[model samples]
Target: MKKQLGDSNILRNWIKGFEYCEIGFNKPPNSLVYLACTSTGRVSNLRIQNLDFYAPFPNAICSLTELNSLEIYNWTGLHGQIPSCISKLVNLRSLVITKTSISGSLPSFSKNTNLIGITLSNNHLSGTIPPSLSTLPNLHLLDLSSNYLCGEIPKGGNMGQFNAANFANNTCLCGNPLPTCFNSAHTSAPAPAPVSTTMFDSAPVPAPVSITIFESTPAPEMAPDSNSEFLSPRDLDTEILLLQMKKQLGDPGFLGNWVIDAICGFTELEYLEIYHLPGLHGLIPSCISKLVNLQILLITNTSLSGSVPGFSNNTNLNVIFLRNNHLNGTIPPSLSTLPPNLSSLDLSSNYLCGEIPQGGNMWKFNAANFANNACLCGNPLPPCFNLAPAPSP
Candidate 1:
């Protein structure tokens, strides 16, 4: 470590070889000395790794108008925004500053297309990468990973050629290389045409997809088209239901609760039937109340598991058949009291409980709709000795 210099005038004579300088980072002196040396235009390289300098950040180094390479790694106590004046170094070829406390945007390399390599990863920099950096002609090494940066990974130029690991660990990034962002709009939207899979996915086997719900004409099972690849097996009926519902509820665009919306999108629909939709998970979403004109809804033999959704707004509903699934929770009295048109509610083969609500249209259904739920009670089943819910442990 160099001792702190008291006189600034004698510092210029301390300058060493023209290609490398590791002295300043270990014991940075007054900012005046850095400016004095770099202004001489003879210092062309900097390699300051783990600099334990006690002095403040010397932004004065930007005066190195002839620098060809600059690397400062793991230098403790180096704090402050990277000076924007460094962009004036039009002769720079390599620039790297990793594992530091540098908190600012990247220093644009003065449109100097001669840049060869860069590594600004593992820092506290928090901003979008400059797309113009890709314009550098000779750049081959790039690593901007492990930052708080968020945005679409740029697809322009040769940037896509880099491995996905080069830009990983950032949230909110989406595009061709990464998975596409959530886009709903499924109805007349065309399915992706058959494209060669080799260029699209690098994985050995295609993974199960979750959110690519689009509409397409039915392909014959005997001679299925390579283009007709849907994540759901019941695509034809779902398509028909979507097309029919599309005529009634103008396309609302698919979201997380889309399956519920699609089933209930029929304001003009009278009878709806569904069976055997596999891998159905999550709570039954609550938008089913939007079906103002639905009278009969029957869904059986599905893997759906969730509490019964609100039927308060579905006054036109006459019969609701949700059996042979793993639905839980008490039947809300609001379903019987609010929907003045409800007559039949089949919640058999589920894990429901509580005294059956005794008001409004609930009395119209017989014992069969309430069967198999051992915990359920009231008029049709044996009365529970206690109406109050058991206290939580």
Candidate 2:
């Protein structure tokens, strides 16, 4: 890193440094940031990345009051408490430090509202999340995954917007987006397996063979935050639409009022193919429409009974094969709005009809792609009535 810093210049009683910011211990494997300059009060953007710094972060950082972004990442052998003095940097907008060995209770961010993102994942940090972090008006993303955090997650404002995947692989986090923390969750609810949308319905109904009916319970008491939404649905009723476990998904706004839930947390999911599960039925959850990142979706040889799921948001779709299912509906022209990345499409052996939208990416499929849809039409298949309309001029 000395090579990256080049020759240094001295100014007055302190040395104003430039670009001592990025240091890595991986090459020769021994350099660490041990800044000891007299405070010149000039730091605006400090990024310390990929190093073997195992010491408490330099206290001199507090003197850099002008700092707006402090990024510390991938520190190996790092073991120390994040100084409480961090609250002194009232100008900080982004604080990201992941993959470190830093351990301790999380600090409060109530002193400032400038923060936009906070990433403290893959560490040994323990204790409940500071509920005050939720009240930051500009806060957008908070990743506390893969830590030893215990207790319930804060569910208010935008806190409920993150995917449950962001909170996965942790120790004993409950309520809202995660499983309920109450004993009522365990004793009163015996949910069955295959997850469907009815799970979020509020009407008094018997639990389906695939879902356990969770008796309602008030959410755990939360740390007070005036900016937070009033806890109305209770922690257990965040009204989550949790599918099966083992699949990470949570978007409480998309789920239930009793608690937080999501249909599928596979935000960037590219490939999905499930088949031959007779226990699966009903129209594919309308929520599949939210998987905007979906690329390959196949529901073949199953008991899936629905109109083909709409992929209007999933423009990256490259292949879609849904054969030998119990689906019936007109092929949505909206599928034509999908990205032209489509390399193949097979909607055969289902009960479908109507002229295929030959606009945009739809005509790329051939006869085999729409095979056995005795009631369908357009190119690749016989036209609905007369010949398929000529390609647009």
Best by TM-score: 2
lDDT of 1 at 255: 23
Give the alpha carbon lDDT tens digit for every residue of 1-393 in model 2.
232223212111124454332222223433223221113535455545455434544566666666655656566555665668878877765676677777776778788566655777777777777778778765544677877777777767557545576677666678777887775221211111110000000111121111111112222454556754664654323223333221232323223323311545445444565544455556777777677766556666677776876778777665576888878877878878875345346788877777877777564345756778647787756556763333211
Q: Where does model 2 exceed 4 Å of error?
A: 1-41, 183-393
lDDT of 1 at 363: 46
Task: List, residue by residue over 206-227, the lDDT tens digit for candidate 1.
Answer: 1211111222212123443476
Candidate 2 achieves a global lDDT of: 0.56
- Candidates in order have lDDT scores of 0.53, 0.56
Poorest 10 consecutive residues by lDDT, candidate 1:
194-203
Pairs in clash, predicted candidate 1: none
Candidate 2 worst ten-residue window by lDDT: 193-202
Tell me the TM-score of each prediction against the true structure: 0.38, 0.41
